[model samples]
Target: MINGRDPRIDFFRGLALIFIFWDHVPGNPFAQLTVRNYGFSDAAEIFVFLAGYAAVLAYGRIALRDGFVVACVRILRRAWVLYVVHIFLLTLLMGIVFVANNHVETRDMIQEMGLSYFVRNPQQALADELLLRFKPNLTDPLPLYILLLLALPLILPWMLRRTEYVVGLSVALYLMVPLFGWNLSAYEGGVWYFNPVAWQLLFVLGGACAIRGQRPSAPQPRPLKQQPLFIVCATYVVISGLITLSWKWPGLHEMLIPKAISDLLYPISKTDLSPARLLHFLALAYCAAKLLPTGQAWLNNWPAQQTCRMGRYSLEVFCLSVLLAPLADMANALAGDTWPMQVFTALLGLGLMMLMASGLELNKRLGTPGRVVAV
Candidate 1:
């Protein structure tokens, strides 16, 4: 059976990218309301996790048809393409911003365009971005994806071939968030905005689900007649309520686990990883997967499919937004807290991204959405 693209997943991806862009836009009211804020509930985790999940669903077929070695090589090359795109866009943004801010002599502009200009300064303000010494931060998504892609060889291997290992490791990693807070210092705050070790677990979970034909985590499934949609909605509400109560009644966090595991439930100072937050995230992810998709034919209409198209090309879209984000930030700063301007910036950014991706796809370049071709 052919496992064609699922419109729901694609639409979800597009929605994530939209929120991601809005979240980065200054003064977005939805920023705090969305899941990307404090702890594991952020959009980053969901996106990255889904990325892994999607990779397995789309590329595992190629891996099965080709050889694992060939598949792994292809994945690495694809990752390198992402890295190049990131650098190319970063250079463009930096150059444009610098020129806008100052009167650059022709010679100075040429000199700034040189790769050395961006890479030479060890202590420069953007040294973290250039050297990859620290994570790209909320300033951009490049650094986060870069790390995840870099480590894919190690993680993806087991996930693709060894089903049990993948599930076990994902759980262990998720559990570790509470046992030992994620160490941003270990990665040199290089990937500060996204914690690969902790966040990878979500992707692994998504991957596992996709690999199993989009089944629930467990083998046992209740019949639709018995599994009421109301139950799923209730589960989500109860989880949200608990998360809210935990915040209001700080003491409720203690009740999240047995006394032995209680220590793992609190936030580690100066880091985003905490079991308490992970609990809420897992709950949210579960609820979303259950509630979304009712096998409706019209749900995948042309307009709805566009959202998935946005998602299918999310990395490219997000990269474009990152390049324009600073510009949006500046626009917002100058325009004051105006929602109209924010909306304008978002539309412009997303349009440019779509155009860029269209160009890339036309040329058969990276970021084109399709199944990976095995060597």
Candidate 2:
């Protein structure tokens, strides 16, 4: 913990931001290195879960320091800020896509980024945008988060009082998604890219964990290696990694895998947070939580420090990444997607993200002067 706040949260959030940037750039060779290439759930899961975890911790601190009223106001205000950022970011992204498309020769940037609807039907697109349903590629997360935060005021009191009950309710709501086909509408006759109804379970679980940590009466987790659950989680993570990696070698994968299992797992929908994907992410989270000590020496190293900085200024870093992705794609495209350009652009993108983070840290310190900044 740094200043009574968990450094691991920021570290993992920052890592997820890097993965998200690499994953978004079309045809970027670094995409192969991202967690998505070898897992059922990717950076999106980390982003959402940690958003909840950090949000609840922050909210709890505020409620204790001020009151429930102040905490509610802060949460609502945050949702509003995210809403405004989403609007401006969408506008800026659309403009960037147009400019990038005009310059790039390899592919149509508009179609590639799924912005063709906005181009064809500007009026309807604007209407949908106002309603938070016209999100293009790379913009789904913020909108989902806005909805989740908006609902927090309604549930936060209950969550603070009885976290386990709230979590149980969240799980029930998640189950209702598949049964009732619950989802929010999207712009072009489709549902949301990240389904809020199904994804809220992770958000709530993250909050529950935060609440548990703050309660003095809550039981501490058992030593991981001594627990049977640790072995089960470790075994599942390894087996799933192998199964995911098998897709790279189609011939061997086809020969080794049974058709029955493949058929069952074929349509693991990220839209609705499929059970298989959810379970895999849970197992993965369990293993990570158990194995990675929070305050390891390596975590305080220079590289890790920079990542933690990025995590601290995640909103700014995330917006920068959304903008940088298109530019990275254009650079690689103009350079003919050579290995050198791929490596350069990938490294350069991360460097830029770190720079933005560092700048934000300096700004925050200058703004606060002697006041202690919350983690």
TM-score versus the correct structure, for each prediction: 0.72, 0.94
- Against the correct fold, how does model 1 do in TM-score? 0.72
Candidate 1 at 68: error in angstroms?
0.6
- After superposing candidate 1, which stretches have Cα over 4 Å from the reference? 30-40, 96-131, 173-191, 214-272, 294-298, 301-303, 351-375
Tell me the whole-model lDDT of each prediction, alpha carbons only.
Answer: 0.61, 0.88
Error of 1 at 254 (Å): 16
lDDT of each residue in 190-266, candidate 2, tens digit only: 99989999999999988877776554553446766678988898888777788889889998789877999889887
lDDT of 2 at 152: 90
Q: Residue 294 of model 1: what lDDT?
A: 40
Candidate 2: TM-score?
A: 0.94
Per-residue lDDT of 340 in model 1? 84
Q: List the residue pairs that clash in candidate 2.
A: none
Model 2 score (lDDT): 0.88
Query: Best-fitting candidate, measured by lDDT?
Result: 2
